[model samples]
Every structure is written in C-alpha cells, then in structure tokens.
Target chain A: MKNFGGHVLFLDRADINTDEIIPAKYLTEIAREALQPYLLESLTLDGFDPKRDIPGKQVVISRANFGCGSSREHAPWALEVNGIRLVIAESFARIFRQNMFNCGLLVVELPCDTIARLFTDYARGETFATADVARGVIQIRTGTKAEEISFRLSDFDRQLVEAGGWLEYADARY
Target chain B: MGQTVAEKIFETHVVDRPAEDVWVIRLDAVLCHEITTPTAILDLMRLGKDRVFDPSRIKAVIDHVTPAKDSNTATQGKVLREWARRHHITDFFDIGRNGVCHALFPEKGFIRPGYAVIMGDSHTCTDGAFGAFTPGVGTTDLAVGILKGVCAFRRPQTMKITLTGELPQGVFAKDVILSVIGRIGVDGATNRIVEFDGPVVQRMNMEARMTLCNMTVEAGGTCGICYADAITADYLWEHIRGEYPDKAAAAADFRKWWPDPDAVYEKTIVHDVSGLEPVTTFGQKPDNVRPVREMEGTPIDQVFIGSCTNGRMDDLRSAARVLAGRKVHPHVRGIVCPATTKIFSEALEEGLIRVFTDAGFCVTNPTCGPCLGMSTGVLAEGEVCASTSNRNFNDRMGRGGRVHLMSPATAAASAIAGHITNSELYKA
Candidate 1:
C-alpha cells in the first residue's frame, strides 16, 4: 500500500493547460530538475501566483478539463519536481491523465458536485489529505474539519504506482 | 456487437490485456520530434535501454526551433539526430528536409488505414485523418513505444460527430472544427475517440480532413478519426499504389477500416455548416470561440499563417488569395510558413510565395516555431496575434502574448486590416 497526498493547492478554473503547467519555452531544456521552479508559472487563475502558491503544496485540487492542450510529459515532470504527487479534479485531458500515472503520480477524478463541495468546504482553509491506495479512500482534513472521500484506481494504474513508474514496470516486464 | 473503426484497429493491434478494459496494443509507427524525443532518448540511455524496437517503424523530425534558436535547442536536435542514426532509422528528416511532424509524417505516406500511431506532440491526432488510430502520448509512453513497440490504454468509447450541409464559401475546415469545439466545450469528449462522419466530412479533401482532426485534442478527444474514402485513396495513391491495382481498388481496401453500420457510439452530435461563418478564438482556451464578425476590429500585432493545423498547400493558396495585391497593415507583422519542404516548393512554383512576400509577410521555411513560441516570430508582452495555428492557450505564442486561432485566410485578412477580421471582405 503506497501513501499519497499532502498540502492542497486549489486551482478553481477548468482547462489548466500544459502551457500553463510548464510553458513551451522551457520545454527545450533536457533535464527534469530544470523544470522545478517553473511549475504553474504561466497559470492565470484569478488570484493564483506561482511564486506565492506553489512552494509547499503537495496536492492539486482543480476544476474540469485540467491539463488540456499540448501533450508534453514536462507538465507532469513540473508537478513531480515541485513535490506534488496527487491531483484531484472534476476531469482531466486524456493524455495528461495517463502521463500522471506513467510518472507514478495520482490524478483523482471526482464528480462535478463532489469537487464543488470539496472547494466550498476546504479550498479557503489550510487543507491536507492522506490518500490510502489500498483502501481506496482519501482522508481530507483542515484545522477544525475532516472528511473521507473515496477514489478508485484501475488495477494497472495501481501497479504502475506500486512499481514506482512506467520505467520500473518496463524494467521488470520488458 | 458491431465495432467502430477505432475498436477494430485496437482489436487488430492488441498484444495483451494488462487489466480489465485495458489493452496493450502494438504500434505501427512511433513519430518523434526534437522538442519531446530528446528527453525520451536520454531517459532510455540512462536506463540502459537505448535500443529501438524497430528502426524502420520510427519517423524522426527536427521541426520545432529548426536551425536551433540557441545551443540548448541545438542540443535537443542533435540528440534526436544521433539517436535516429544510432538506431539505423532511415526516415529521419533533418533541418533542410524537416517540417512539422504531423504534416511531414503523413506527407511521406507513412500512415495508412487501420494503423496505430503515437507521437509525443498533441497535434499527432492530425494523422487520424488517414483513418488510422493515431493518438498523442507523453514521453514515457513514447519511450515505451520506441523501445517495445507497445503501449497500453483503456478501451476508448466512440463519439460520432456527423457533419451535415455544405461548407459556405468563405468557411473552411478550420471554422468547422472551431465551431465543433465551441459546441462541445473543452472537455466534452474526454477519454473518448471522436469519429467524424457525414456529408461534409465526406466531401473534404485530405488537407481539410487533417484540419478537422488536428484540433480534436482541444475538445479533449483522444483521437479524431475519419473513414477512408476515395479522396483519401487519391491523396495516398502515390505511396500506396504498389499494394493496390488502381485508385478504385485502393479506396475499396481502405474502406475496410470504416465502422460497421450497427457500430455503437457513446454519444452522437451533428453540425450543419450551411450557414457557417469564419470563426476565431476570443480568449485563452481553444473552445473560447466566436464568429469572425463579432471579433472583427479587435486589434492585432501579428498574423501567423502556419502550423500542422493549416499549413498545407490549400491553406497557403487561400491565404495568398487574400493577400495577393494588398500589403500587410503597417501596424501588423505577418509570417507564413509552409508545412513541409515539398509544400514550400509547390507554393513557390504556384507563385503563392511571391504573393505572400509581396504582401509584406515574411515567408519562412517550414518549422513549428512561433506556433509554440520557441522562435521565428515569438510575441512580446501585451501583444495579440491573429493565428491560423491551433491552441490559443495563454502565453502559448510567448509570455503575456495572446493568440487568437482562425483560418489562414482570416489570418491573412487580419494582417491587411491590422485586426481580427473575416476573409469574406477580401474574397474575390
């Protein structure tokens, strides 16, 4: 059973694209660590500031269609380098969702109403979550409130996370 | 239990069932480009798994930041060049020959009906116009496709988009796709394969079909597919002639990839383009669409007419038609990049290049630059561009730059007007 989740960063907008995750200009760089400081650098959510908002957050809560536009693994690499491992959203672009799993990060797709509730209940507070892969539930808490939310990962996705990433899985199988 | 074209292709390519509803499918082609492939190549080397599964099945190109914007970009191109050579991949297209990968690969006739293709760039879905199961992947899956020739996916449900009625005189495939995206919203088709069908799609040539499928990703579609028809056969006849006796035979053979009449779709939507007008993106997202009429007179600093989406010969000809005698507005800078070296040569011979140059548009060699803001015509802060390329995401063209997506004709017209405007006013 692997552990997931941490401090939550709530991005309230939909269609948070790859360009926003890691701008196309930085994509010329070869190293993954080179992407660390630039995570969400171009995101233009109402009051979000990458320099102020991304430092210690280890999880992302966002609206629908997160990670849309341009299929770049650098998007996930940016998140990973920033020490974020879990993303909870109403939905995600197809390639971005798979890329997250390939990198051993988790993208939890909650229903629209559920995500709205999560934002209403926790977004303004200092939120933290503890995700249990084995039990398929996430324990979300703030200073004075706590809630349990369940998530399901496909068997292959769970295997990828347990193996650490696609590279490790390929090492064993291929 | 009839199957869609995507389902049939997946069935044919399946190598294993990794999990329930998850099938590991063998890839027929793995498309690679400088911007994304270098990281995959480096990772494979670090893991001591640098060998490709099949050298011949790989197609490599140096399209993004071509001629290299700086040493870092030069290194990225060099990495892909050396990797292709080391793997004995003969289909590598270097600086003088390279173009945008999505346009270049299909131009070489590498894609065919029923093929399963993957690339590291999102616009790779443009290849699905050939009636293939082509989808974009990330670097990790790209590395796996390169190394083992296999990638996994959950079975994608199909969403059928039936395009009815006729395309209006000034409305092109770019407008049609933009309209579709607007109707569906950005994530309307998430995790689904969109199968484009009906009379309008049937009438479109391969270039138009590619434009329709190219932006499917903007609507969150994994792949946008079209059924192979006589037009597809005619376009592919040069490369596929050896397999079939004649164009008719080739068309018939390719038709095997079409979905069965009883095939099920998760949902169906229809669009009638009889009164369709030129459209453009108003905001950062691709789905933030508006008719060119409403967005007209919105000032623009640049007009870019290129990218895999609309950089074909027809696109250039359309743009040239608008710019034939009119000079670009003094306040605006215009750039035109043909999609491929072949298209560039043809456009030169057709005098389209002269038309563009006469109009004060900087005619450049084929590169995906400026489309993603790497080079060629990057925008400065507070700048707005009327662009023919897809994806209007904020800062996509440059930091603090705004990109409004439209057709090449509209882009050219905007260059003349110095604002976001329709091409109808310029049409002969």
Candidate 2:
C-alpha cells in the first residue's frame, strides 16, 4: 500500500451530500475522466471552483456526513479524478464511504475534536497533512508545528483501502 | 437467540463462513438503474467478464431521467439497453416499462421476503418493506454482485422502531416517516437496520409500508424492514400476482420470515401517531421536517409530487382527492410523476390524471426526473418548491432553488394555495 499526503482543502459543512460533490447535471457523462472538473461543483457558490480549487489540494478535510445523499459513485470518481486521494471527515454517509473505497479514495473518520482542530489549524494558515496508510496515523504539519491523530478502521476496510480499492482488493482475493 | 429478520437473511446467505463473521454473502436479487449501470457495465468490460453470474436475479431499469432528458442521457440509456440485451438480462425494464427502480422492483415481485437484495441506488432499502435485507450499493458493488453473485457486508446493529396507534385521516405514511426523521435527525440510524413493528406498521398496506422503508435511508439506515404477514401476502397476491398471474404460486411463498419477539435490538423507540399531523421539511435535510401547519404561508414557486418516496397509487390518490375540483395557483408550477408505468396507467384509468391536468399541473410519465435535479421540473434560481420527493438538500431540484419536502397531499395543497400548507385546510 502506498502512503499518500498533500495539502488540504477544508470544507466546514456538516453534511456535504453527493449532489454537492458532483451535481446530477454532470452525472450524464459516463466516464470517470469526464467527471473531473465537476468535483464539489456546488462549492463554487462559496467561490471554490472545481478546476481551480481541486488541483491545489490532494486531501479534503470536512465535518460530519461528508458524503450524504445519493449513491452516486460519481462523487468519489470526481474527487479521485480531481486528485483527491485522502478524505478526513468526522463521518460519512454509508454508500459514499463504500464508493470511496471501491474507487481508491481513502477516507478516515476522526473524532469531532480532531476535525475541529484540523479546521482551526487550516484557518490559522496551516494546510498541509500526510496520511500514512501503513501506520493508520495522519501527521498534521504546519511551519514549525507538528501534530498527529490516529483514526479507527476495521480490518476489512483497512485492507481494502490499503490494497488501493475494493476492485484491487477483490481481484487479489478472487 | 432470537434474531431480527435482517440477521436471519444474513445468516441464511453467509458465504463459506460463520454467520456472524461472514463478510461476503450471496445476493438473492440485484437491481440497477440507467444512472448507475453505465459505469457498472464499464467495470464489467474492464474485468473482462461478459456474463452476469445470474441474469434472472439481476434487474436493470431505466427510470432515472427516463425518456432521456437530454442527448447525453439518451445515449447512455441506449448503451444500457444494448448491454442488457447482449447479456440477456431477463428482468430489464425499458423507459416505458418501468418508472422508478425502487417502486418497480417490488411491484414486479422481484423483492420477496427473506431475500438479500442489493441495488445501485440508495433507496434500495425500500424493498425492506417485504422483510428483506436490502442495502444500497454503488456501481462497483453492483459489478461485484454481477460477477460473483455476492458482495461484502458488515453486520449492522439493529434499531427497532415500534409504532403504536393509527394515523388520523389527513395524515399519511409520508408524514409518519417525516415525523420519525425529524425526531431522530438525519444520521440517527446510520449503518443500522431499522425494524418497524407494532400495530401501525402491521396495518399499513404494501404501498404505505414501502413508503416507510423508502425513507429509511434518509435517516442513514441501511434498511427499514417490516415483518412479512398476511397483509404482505395479500398485497403481492392482489397487486403483483393478480397482474402477472404466473407468479401467483411464487407470491404465496413470499411470506416466509419475520423477526422474533425476543430479538435483540441495539435501540428500541416507540412512536404513537394517533395525533400526528402532516409534516414537511423546512431546510436542506430530510430531518428538518416540520408540521405542514407550522410552515404554512411559506410561498412556493413550484410543487412536485412523485418519486420512489410517495409516487405510488395511494399517494397520488390522496393528492388527487385534495385537488379534485381545485385549480393550481397561478404562481405555482406543479408536476406529478407517477412512480411506475403501472401506477400511471392505473391513475389514468381511475381519472386521477384528469384531476391533475384539470388543476393546471403537468402530469408526466413515470420517471425520477427532477427529483434529484437531473431533468424535468427543475427549479430556477431562488425559486422555492414544495416537493413530495425525499431529500431537500440545497440545489437538490436545481441550483440555488429551495425545496420543502412534504407528503403528496401537502404538495398538492401547496400547489393550490401557492404556498406550503396543510391539506386539511384546503377547500375542495
């Protein structure tokens, strides 16, 4: 399993549904590559352009229920295509979490305090973090400051995400 | 130890492992819609697997954005049709043949009791109305099911919701669920199986029961299941088998399981609904539900009545009763979508379509258009819509539009009043 880390794009909302991740308008496009520019398309209202903002970050940090509403795999596809490899949120909608695992996007569920701290640190201009899939720990780094938070993952989910996704995990098994 | 219905289904299908430890279980049925199947087929092609493990067990329908809203979706639909045809998937339903995937699956007798059903749509939990263990999956999971006839699962804890007392005349199943969601909050039942029990659930007709299970996902539940009883048998016999007839014998055997009285539950909640009022959502979450009377006078620019949530016969009939002789308000643009072709035909036969059309409402064919902001009655910027469909997320019906989620009766009432209001106050 490859460890990945990058700058974080912080979304403060509690329930960022799939529709907001990739609006239904983009769903007509069948290819994952075609879904690239629409990741968090609705966030444009908050002045975050999918093309401009997504490329600047490879890890997304959000509050609870980070992927609620609709079982659209396009949500993860859009994020993955936009170069988002790791998502750290307080929680996630069930199917969205499943889709993330299936499509090779790593999701870590942290405590609300941990997520709040991430937001606080990011707001204070500290926006870089690294996720060590091998260690089950996320190293939070800012200039001259360092912190770490561990997350819980079941054996099944850890194995799937570690293997690069459900498809890879399944193929390896069967 | 007594196990819930979901536990039993899991126990029955656990693949080559102990029931409690089983991570993979064989699926009795798998369903997909046009929106998800295109990608699923792509995965299948990538896997170099041409045939589904069990074609008959796989049901694919083109209901979401059906009649193809645009050229892109139309092309995708054509591709799905061609793929289903090539695979000889027997239960595939075309645009005119099906309405919404959730509604049509159970209506076609594809979801029977004791089945472990999976669909590539979140509302697949709707089949839990028949005591089935259903969890909505994504495209890859659907592909997995197609190839292996099984998918991985984590055993979920159970939440038992016991409903006592009868619904008042003006109240409906939509109200019942909305009230529950309002109490529990949106993620209250996250990753849990919610088992509905007690008198109210037992007395609810199949369509009403389906409505309860339909919104289970709104509460973040994996499934909302009701025990199968004579009512379930009667509904399948009367509504499904009576139409198909070849499935009459099969329907007889559909009523196979229920949770035991002593089944262990992680949480047990009791709700008495004898005085429950019609409910509607005021904000972006399904759990943001409020009584219709409380939100009355909130102006609405559009009203939508239909979806897997409440587009069934009873829901439309209730809406029709409210709009029987009334005209829709000039400020409101209303659309009523029957959930299935069968329901559309039946409503047309019963003259419900005439009522909607006479009231200045556009009654379209059975499709899930606009319910998720795909196509059809999308709301323009700053427009407020009263919708019967589930989910009131921001821009859910369209970008920058606000949605008030309500029962069909409330949506119909709002259409007539030009604002979100209660059906009981509307004059015939």
Candidate 3:
C-alpha cells in the first residue's frame, strides 16, 4: 500500500464505538458500496458530516477505543469506501482493528500525548501532515519546530499492512 | 506454560502458528443467517465458487427478518433460501423452523466442545458457552470459510474470571454476568478469551452457562469458555442428543478437554456475587448497569424477554414465575418470544405461555424481533423498553428506541410494575 498523508479530520471524541461508525439500521445493505453514504451518520460531531466532510480528508484521528462495539465489518468498509486510507487513534478496539486490516485500511495507534497534540495543532490551523509508514513517523507540515511523531507496528503487522491487507497477504503467501 | 481452554483449542486447531501469530484453522461449523448469508453467498459466487466445501458443516438459518418485514428483506431471505437449497446444505432452517441463530444452533446439536465455530453474527460468541471457541466474523471471512473450510485467526490472550460464592435465591446467572460487566468496562476484555470458572460456574446448568457467555461480546471479548464437565455431559445426553444414544456416548469425549490446573492466564479476576441483586442496564451500553431495585419506578414503554441470551426454557420459567398471577400494566406492552420452536413447544406444554398470555403479554413465534429492530415488535420514537436481550445501544430496537437490558425475571417484574423493578419485590 502506498503511504498517504493529508489534512486529517479530527473527531475529538473518546470511546467512539462501531455503532457510531455504522448504525444497526444500515447493516441491512449487504453491499459494501451501498453502505458508504451512511458512514458515521449517527456520529454528531461539530462541523463534520461524514457523508459531506470526508472527501478531502485522507486520515481520521479519534480518541481511545475508537472502534469499540459490534463486530461489523461494514464499519471499516464504510470508512474505506468513503476514502479514509489511514486511521490514527489513541487506541482501537480489537475487532475493528482486525476488520480494518482485513479490509485494506491502515490503522496506527500512537501515544495519547502525541494524539492530543495532533488535535491541538488542527485547532490552531496546522492542517498539513505526512504519514510515512516506511519511516515509522508522522511529520507535521506547518510547525515552528519540526515535529516528527513516531508510531509502533510489529514486523508481522508492518509486512501485512504495507502489503495492502490480510487477504492479499494470504493470497501472496499461498 | 499451562493454557486456558481457548489457548488449548487454538493450539490444536491452528496450523503451525505460535501464540499471537495468525494461523488458518479448520472450522468445525460455520453458521450464517438471512441478514448475513446473502452477502457471503455473493462473495462466494464472486470468487467463482459454485458449491460449498462441506455442506454438512455449514448452517444457514433465516431468523433475523422472518415473515419478511419489507420487500428488501424478503428478497434477501429468498436469495439465502435459494442458495442453501441449491447448494444442498444439510442444516438450513427456514422461518418456521428457525429461531435466533445462537440459541437454536446448540439446542439442535450443531455446537460441541473442542470445536472451532464461526458465524456471521456478532453474538456467535454465545456458542463459546459449550466449551467451543466461537468468534463472530464478517461476510468476507465467512465466505472464505464456506469455500475453504478454514479461516485465519490469531491466538488471543486469555483472561480467567472465577465466580466465587453461591448465588442467592432470587439472583440468576444474568445478574452474575451483568455484575462482572459492571466491574470491567465495556471494552475491558477486547480480543481476549474470557474463561469462566470457579464454584458458581461449576454449579450452573447449560442454560445458565450460555447466559454467562452470551454477553461476552458486550465486553468486546473474542470468546467466553466454560470447560465441559458432568453438567455439560448431562446436558448433551438429556437435552441435545435425546433419543440418540450413540451421540450421547460420543459426547462423553468432551470431558477430556478441561483447562489445565495451573493454566497461565494473562489476567485472573474473581467476582463474589453471593448477595447480588437482579441487575439491569440503565444507559446506552450493557455495562452501564445497576441493581434493578435501585432503578425502580423508572418508566418503561415495553418489556421484551426473548433473544439468544435469555430466551431459553429456564429464562421463560423465571419470567413465568414472576408473571404467573400478575397482569401487565396498562401503559406497557409486553412481548414473550421463545428462542426456538422447541422452546416454544416446551413453554406451551408447561403452561408458561399461558402465564404470559394471561398477563397480557403478546406471545409470538421464534424470531429475533425488536432486538436488531428488524420487525414484529419494533419500538416507536422515544419508546423505552425493558428487554432481556444483550445490547442496549442507541437505535438498536428502532429509531430513538431506548432499551434497558435486564434478566427475564427483572423484565417480567418491570412489565407488571410499568417500570424497571426487580422480582424480589413481587408477591406470588
């Protein structure tokens, strides 16, 4: 997968579960493409409508336990289809993290302090950023001091995440 | 190091993989329902797979949108029915024969100890109560399993929860599990295999153990396991394999796979619930729970005592005992849905259905109604329901539908009181 970075959409909320990401009603739409417009519709963040606001943002940053409830793969599919390539959160729920990797989305978990700073920088009009998965750092574009925030990924996960997803990795291996 | 039951199961099933490494494991049983099977079928067809690898090992049930609420759900159900029939799947349960997938699968002897079970629904973890490692999967992975008979899984860390002390007379296993959720936050056990043990679990019946394991998904746990014992063997012989002596004899092998005495757990927790009260959820999350007595007089619009979680015969009996001589409140609507046709027939023979019917409850056929907001009893806007199902998330039942999760006894008592009340205050 190609490394990507752009203006990040900051949803300053804690414990945002999968229910907020994709509501139960929309799960009836079996196709992944049909569920895209309804992504995060239930999440009422200020100045952000997921259907309208997601086109320009390449990354989504959220608080701890970002995808917390329900093992619905549609949650990640909705985000991926709606043009979210990477997600940086303080932490992630296990199933959603797995779903993201399975559906070809890059998810990174950074320390809480650095995540808080990213949100603060966004508020202060520091919009541009770069996520270099190969370099293991997220660099700020417009900062007084050059900010290079490092993230963690195990060798096994790096190989899978860098290769697009689990299914592709599995296909390549077999 | 010694391993928990889940670790042991993975050790045996996962091919050439260490702990925490992804390994493709052969799935003993794969279940898909109407709402999910359609997509999985499409994916399978997209992969140019015309037939299921093992039709006998796959179970396709239509329980989510039974009787077809609308044309879309009807089409989906039809697609699944046609696919199952065309593929000659051995265990396909249609609407009349189907119930909630989690409850009916085990009752029909589809689940057994020491097996790797997977289903499209998130509550598939309910089968973990049978000492099997069951995890919920999405349609893609489910489709892959249907074609290949295997799915990739990483060995999860294990947690041991020891339930100490005997349950009080009025308390139930639902109360015990709700209390545990209150201790651990909603996402506290995410991706961890929660192994239930100790004195209380040993004494609980299969139904009670299922109740304990049913809500593990609410804690974001991968699976919840209780090692097979004499009770499990007796359950299989008497309940599951009735009139089939050979299956009962074969089921005796389940007892050999209990956790090692010194099993190494990532975390071990002990909960003492000897004097626990009947618990219920107050807010949106299931873990947002309180004692039913503490939340009395909290207004409710409906009471639903059915789902895979607490819709078994024992759950029905508990509700029946509470609503025997009582009438449902005028303002509240009460619904009693058995988990399966077998449960419905048993409740009918035992006069539990009569008790519910006499109390103004609308006893219905086996369907997962109002739980996922499909149909049959969908709540209206601003409606508050006291339900025995697992979740209480926002808009779970209907648009702006509020749910208070509770045990069957608490739900029955609340139906009578027109509020969230416990069975302890009810008089026979």
Which one wins on TM-score? 1
Residue-wise C-alpha lDDT for candidate 3, range B111-195, written one tens digit per residue:
8889898887778888888899998877666766777677777767889899999898779988998889888978778878899
Clashes (backbone N, CA, C under 3 Å), per candidate, total 0, 0, 0
Give the per-residue lDDT of model 2 (tens digit) for B1-428: 88878878878887744233336888998887888888888777877875678888888889888788678899889878988888889888886788798889888878878989898889998999988999998988888787778888777689999999989978988999999999998889987899998999988999999999999999989889998777777667645555544554545455457776788999999999999988898878899987887898999999999999999999999999999999999988989999999999999999999999999999888888879888889888999999988889878889999988888988998899998888998746
What is candidate 1's lDDT per residue for A12-123, written digit by digit as tens?
9888999999999999999999999899989988888899998889999999889998899999999988888899999889999999989888888889999999999999
Better of 1 and 3 by DockQ: 1
Sort order, TM-score high to low:
1, 2, 3
- Report the CA-based lDDT of candidate 2 relative to the real structure: 0.84
Q: Could you tell me how far off, in angstroms, the CA of residue B129 lies in candidate 3 after the best superposition?
A: 0.9
| Residue B61 of model 1, lDDT score | 95
- TM-score of structure candidate 2: 0.95
Q: Which sequence of candidate numbers ranks them by DockQ, best first?
A: 1, 2, 3
- TM-score per candidate, in order? 0.99, 0.95, 0.94
> Where does candidate 1 stray beyond 4 Å?
A1-3
CA-based DockQ, model 3: 0.46
True contacts kept of each: 0.88, 0.55, 0.32
